[model samples]
Target: MAILITAKNLKKSYGKGKNTVHALGPIDFTVVEGSFTIILGKSGSGKSTLLNLLSGLDSPTDGTLVVAGESLNKLKSGKLAKYRAKIGLIFQFYNLLPNLSTLENVMISSWLKGISVSKQDATSLLKQFGLEHRINSNIKTLSGGEKQRVAICRSLINKPAILFCDEPTGALDTANGQIVKDILVKLNKEGMTIVMVTHNEEFIPMADKIITMKDGIIESMNTQISK
Candidate 1:
């Protein structure tokens, strides 16, 4: 597979001098195209920090990060916004507007990215996720699983080159989490490049690569065939 993301001694720190908090690397890693990659660690392990850096949510204090041929660490605000549009983001908490219907929630993401998505396409995505019946329901009225499925549909509406997820299934119950996990696996199998961070070990075995972190550093990395 081709390299879709590459980091070289990537690092992030906050504050300055004596009060500084070194939150993440001085680390290096690569994500290959069409691979399911997981970054696993407990809270404060810097997994989220790594995800933020990877997704261009924050810039590195030092080192380099390149995704989809653009250097994230070096991009200006406008360029960074453009880079971000090429990716999709999902989080533990479904970040949908409670006032909006499921269909509206999905359509909004494309609008935010400067792309106009028709209602038909958005509905099709929701229908494919088994959420056809709830597409007209307000997010506040939907169950947790329904809310999350809407989030997934919203993320995909832009046709992002990479999907970046942070604890995607962490907020769901067992059955719902399984549904989310299965959907993710299905997406990866269908050629979505996914990079997810979570505290759950259950996701590791199913991924093409696993990066384990502890205390803001890599503890180990393993590669295996996708399950």
Candidate 2:
């Protein structure tokens, strides 16, 4: 497989001089295309910081990060915005507009990315996520799991090359989390690259690459064939 993400000596810090705090990196790794990679770490371990940098949401203070052939360190704001359009992001809290229906919520993402919105395509994605009956329902009316499924549909509407998720199932119950996890595994099997950061140990074996981080650095990295 081709490498889709490459980081060399990547680092991030905050404050200055004696007050400077190193948040992440001076680390390196590559994510192969279509691989499901998990970043495991505790709170304040810099896992989220690493995700932000890799997804082009934040630039590193030093070193290099290239995603999908774009050099993040060299891209300006406008270019970075364009680059981000090709990357999908999911958060612990379902980031949906409460007043928007499920279908509208998914449609809006494509519109924001300057892509034409197609209701048929949006409905198709919602159906694929088992949300066909809830397509026209308001976001607030959906259950936590249903809402999260909508968020995933929105993320995929742009057909991003890589999906970056930060604690995607942190708010759900075990059954619901499993529902989301199953979807992620299916997506990976179908060749969508995924990078997920979580404290949940249950997800480790599901990845093609597992990276464990602690105190701003990688503690261990293991590779396995996708199950």
Q: Mind sharing the TM-score for model 2?
A: 0.96
Model 2 ranges off by over 4 Å: none
Residues 1-227 of candidate 2 have per-residue lDDT tens digits of 99999999999999899999999988999999999999998999999999999888888999999999989987888988898899998889988988899999999999988999789999999999999999999899999999999999999999899999989899999999999999998998899999999988788878899999999999998998745
Evaluated with lDDT, which candidate comes out highest?
A: 2
Q: Quantify all predictions' global Cα lDDT against the true fold.
A: 0.91, 0.92
lDDT of 1: 0.91
Off by over 4 Å in 1: none
After the best TM-score superposition of candidate 1, give how far the Cα of residue 148 lies from its true spot, in angstroms: 0.9
Minimal lDDT window, size 10, model 2: 218-227
- How far out, in Å, is residue 173 in model 1? 0.6
Model 1: how far is 61 from its true place, Å?
A: 0.8
